[model samples]
Target: MIEIALGALITLCLLLTGTCLWLLTNQREHARWQVERDARDALRDQRIKELSKRLDAYLTGSVRMGEELQELRRIVAPLPDKLNQMEQRDPSSLSFTQAARLVGMGASVEDLTQSCGLTQAEAELVSKLHQAQRRKS
Candidate 1:
């Protein structure tokens, strides 16, 4: 009976040691997994910050472009009325406008006189003005 009790005690001690070792290994595994998860969360947060900055820049540029477009629209709105006024003021001015367009398209003085009914002196003047405007630009 004494020998049997000693053997049972030794077996119980071995079992307790094995259980303790298993619990320790399990705890270490959980700690390692938590660290890896924290690292991944940190990386994800960094990426989110970078994307947020890029999105802000893009939105700022878009707003700037929208403002520019609005200004362009405001400037262009009066053009049609001005054009009508110019057309109503002088019939000869319309011919001059047409002759200027022809000159801009590389028309010769003769072409302007024939096609646009501009006088020779007027055609020459238009050609000179077009040349000067091109040089200024």
Candidate 2:
């Protein structure tokens, strides 16, 4: 009976030691897993913050681009009217070819200047040059 009791006490101690080791190992694994999960969560949150900042920057750029485009449109709005006015001024000055023809017909320099809107010196030059050409021909 004494030998049997001693054997039972040793067996119980071995079982208790095994259980304690298993619980300790399980607790360490749980701690490691918790740390990894926290790291992953922190990384995900950081990425989300960066993405939000980028989106805000893109939105701001889009709004600025839209405003610049509107300003450009406003600045250019009167260009067509100004172009039409310039086009309509065609009747102000007679064509250079017409002035040359008139010079060939013996029109005076003053007449060429007034009718063709040429400067006095330009009219004189054209008259002299064309008269010389006519004499040669």
Candidate 3:
């Protein structure tokens, strides 16, 4: 009877030891998984921050471009009015040849012709005259 009781006690101790080792290994695995999850979350947050910064820079550049375009428009907005006043004061004052030269100076042919009510032939004559002037210069 004594031997049988001792054997039972030893078997119980072995079972308890195995259970403890299993629980310890499970806890370690759980800790490792938690660490990996935290690392992934951190990496994801860093990527999000980088993308947001890039988006802000792009938006800033676009705003700057828009502002520059507006400035250019403002600078050129009074040119048509000045041309119209000049046209009203002198229809024939600027000869077709002179008008052509003005066209060559970056004035649109349509705008120059319309403002002066010039025929295509007259516009061409002005262009030829401007070309001659350019050659002289």
Which is better, 1 or 3, measured by lDDT? Answer: 1
Which tens-of-lDDT digit does each residue in 7-50 have in candidate 2?
99999999999999999999999999999999999999999999
Which candidate tops TM-score?
Answer: 1
lDDT of 1 by residue, 1-137 (tens): 99999999999999999999999999999999999999999999999999999999999999999999999999999998998788778765446778888889999999998887778999999999999999999
The Cα local distance difference test for each model comes to 0.92, 0.91, 0.82
TM-score of 3: 0.55
lDDT of 3 by residue, 39-86 (tens): 999999999999999999999999999999999999999998887777
lDDT of the structure predicted as candidate 3: 0.82
Regarding TM-score, does 1 or 3 come out ahead?
1
Residue ranges of candidate 1 with Cα displaced over 4 Å: 93-137
Local error of candidate 2 at residue 120 (angstroms)? 25
Model 3 clashing residue pairs (backbone): 96-126, 97-126, 100-126
Give all TM-scores, in the order shown.
0.65, 0.55, 0.55
TM-score of 2: 0.55
> CA RMSD for every model?
7.1, 11.9, 9.5
lDDT computed for candidate 2 = 0.91
lDDT of 1: 0.92
Candidate whose lDDT is highest: 1
